[model samples]
Target chain A: MLISNMEIIPGKQIQKHFGLVQGSSVRAKHVGRDIMASLKNIFGGELKGYTELLQESRDEAMDRMQQQAHAIGANAILNVRFSTSSVAQGAAEIYVYGTAVILE
Target chain B: MIELTIFLVLMTLGYLVGQYAEKKHYQSIIEREKRLSGLTTVASRFPPPGKQHDQCLVLGSVVISVDYFKRFIAMLRNLFGGRITSYEALLDRARRESLLRMKEQAAKMGAEYVFNVKYETASISKGRQNTIGSVEVLAYGTALMRPRDEA
Candidate 1:
């Protein structure tokens, strides 16, 4: 299915709207990664491990959202948005939502 | 005591190294911003009309951890009821870096413009006292590209 963050895709028309679909994933950092992150904190640089972890989680969330849209017979997902929230001490939730639609 | 000495040592190391890294990152960010200035990004939802373009999602995200010195400064600032300048710079750097990375990705795809850009910030290590604090910044947008036949 086609996915975009814009409300309208250029050169295309929305044939039908399938309301909203959302997906979310909650993930926690492993102890080993947390230890490595603490070490990196001393020097105040980018945490590559955490970055990759979050990215992977976000991709998974988007994949799930796409699955939901597909199940509803939509061919495209538009106006997508992403949010991240820390639910617990070590866990974060990646949430994504969008309007499912059929484009022509 | 030895514990106090270790704290001082870590603070000093964090200050010196963190300052150097921030300076280097700013330099690179400035250079890349100038290089990619031609490809613009906007927060408007609608693209310019009358042109058929391919739309796709592009995003860049980063996780930046606080240094010992900055964290100490922020803690003290919390008590003083004043602005935490240390974190202001940290977050500024993170946001700019994330945007630059997103622009680079759009450039790779030969996208002319990025629209409906948005940013999401999350504190990854929140709610745990005395733990190292880190914030994750994610910037995303829809990249509009000229159709392949037109390109």
Candidate 2:
């Protein structure tokens, strides 16, 4: 399904709106990754392990959102947004939401 | 005495390695920024005036952690309650890097301008006392995809 943050798609037209659809995932850092991260932290740099983890989590969340859109018989999601929060120590929650719509 | 030695060792390690890492990151950011200069990024919720084109959602995220030395310094700074330059630099880098990544994603999707850009930031904690272990930055926007022949 097509996904965008713009309220209106240029080529396509919105035929029907299915309201809001959302997906979320909560992830925590493992001991091994944390060990590696701490070592890298001594040098101050990007934590590749954590980056990869978050990326995966985001993709998963997006996938779930798509699934919701598909279940609702919508062809697209619009005005998509992402939010992150620290739910626990070493853990993060990612939420993605958008309006499901039928595009033609 | 042993504590002093460990602190010295960690401080030197942070100084040497952190400096190298920061330099490398800065160079990388500059290079990417130059490469993506063709794409426009704006914070306004409204799209730029132009021939209506397609639009897509694009996002980029990054996580950065401070060095041990910087954390230690920050802890000390807490006592005096002053701006921590070390953390300031770390956060600045994270923010810019995430934006660059978002631009890269938009460019890949054949979008010329990224509009309605937004940023979300969260701090991951490590200890019970709420010590910030790492910071995550998420940048997202709508990319206005124009016709390929418009150029």
Candidate 3:
């Protein structure tokens, strides 16, 4: 629950090493977005479709990571990082990872 | 002369297509590599975190960066606009890869847990922003072995 930029909390205590937990999500948008984006390449407008896709994937991956942390009874996670990749021609993968830590 | 011109044109076209495919493929590989970066190996034995352990271990995490220059110029085309910039792609990959490397290191160290992790992102370009950057994410934690009472 408590998220900090640093590893050790200034005053908080942590206990029990939860096995390293991670979560990943795969997402895709209408090829329509790519088509529209190409057009925007000339007009230079926003790519709304990919934006929505990334947002959705971000939440999903975080949720999965949290669930894994919960199973380990971690009160919080540290050193969280995110990554993305194209899994296929049309799909993309988003992954999140961190060390699960709990206050004793 | 005609054959030479035709050959040049074909090469140019091939280069264009290859450029696009490379971005997609390379980014995916980096992401997968990040996903698997953490410790997959099981520890034979170790005390859990928060126990009254004497020996403490620390870990640092970092993400590898790919700045603009290193990527294709057209990817530069993707930068100024687009929902997803090529820079975002590289940063994302770096984040994943760095974390994986940290986890691997922690597992190797035989630490029960990695605590106090830190992430440091630098240009690695000396001072230029136009460069294909490197993100070094450092993860550090105190590793300790505790007695049964501490657990």
Candidate 4:
């Protein structure tokens, strides 16, 4: 299925709207990675480990949202948005939502 | 006394190294921004009309941690109730770097324009005593690409 953040696809039209479909995942950092991150914190640089971790989580969330759209017989998802929140220490929740629709 | 000495050492190290890294990053960001200026980015909710193009989602994210010295300064600023310039710079760098990375990805995919761009910022770890440990910035957009046959 096609996923986009724009409200309208350039040349296509939406036939049906399935409202909002959302997915979320909560993940905690590995202990080893945390140690490395702390060390990096002293020097104030990018945390590659955390970046990869969050990216993975976000992709997973998007996949789940796509699955939901598929289950509802939608051909595309539009107006997609993402959010991240700290659920607890060392753990974060990646949430994504979009409107599922059938395009013609 | 030993703890105080250790704090001082870490603060000095953070100040010197963090400043150097920030300068280098800014330089690189500026250079890349110039190179990538051709890949236009916009926050409009819809793509321009009359173009039949393939579209896909693209994103870039980064996590940046605060250095010891900067964190200390932020703490002091907290007491005074004014702008935290150190953290401000940190966030500014993170935002620009994230957008650049997103543009780089779109360019790699042969996209000519990015639309509906959005940004999300989250504090990953608050650290002990309520200090921000690290911040994550994510920029996402829909990339409009020429049709395969045309490109």
RMSD of each: 1.5, 2.0, 14.8, 1.3
Residue A47's lDDT within candidate 3 is 38
Per candidate, native contacts kept equal 0.88, 0.72, 0.01, 0.87
lDDT of 2 at A65: 98
- For candidate 3, the per-residue lDDT at B40 reads 38
Error of 1 at B1 (Å): 0.7
* Interface CA RMSD, all predictions: 0.9, 2.0, 13.9, 1.1
**What are the Cα lDDT values of the candidates?**
0.90, 0.86, 0.52, 0.92
Which 10 successive residues of model 4 chain B have the least lDDT summed?
B125-134
Fnat measured on candidate 1: 0.88
User: What's the count of clashing pairs in each model shown?
Assistant: 0, 0, 29, 0
Q: Model 4, residue B46: what's the lDDT?
A: 73
Q: Model 2, stretches more than 4 Å misplaced?
A: A11-13, B126-128, B148-151
Winner on lDDT between 2 and 4 is 4
Would you give me the overall lDDT of model 3?
0.52
What C-alpha lDDT, on a 0 to 100 scale, does residue A80 get in candidate 1? 95
Choose 2 or 3, whichever is better by lDDT. Answer: 2
Write model 2 residue lDDT over B1-151, tens digit each, in one string: 9999988999999888888889899999999999999898987776655476777788888999888888888889989998988889889999999999999988888887898889888886655456565788889988888766686
In the range A1-104, model 3's lDDT, one tens digit per residue, is 64332355433567766756789998766768767644433322123455456557767987898898888788887656666655554466767787888866
* lDDT winner: 4
- The list of candidate 1 runs beyond 4 A from truth reads B130-132
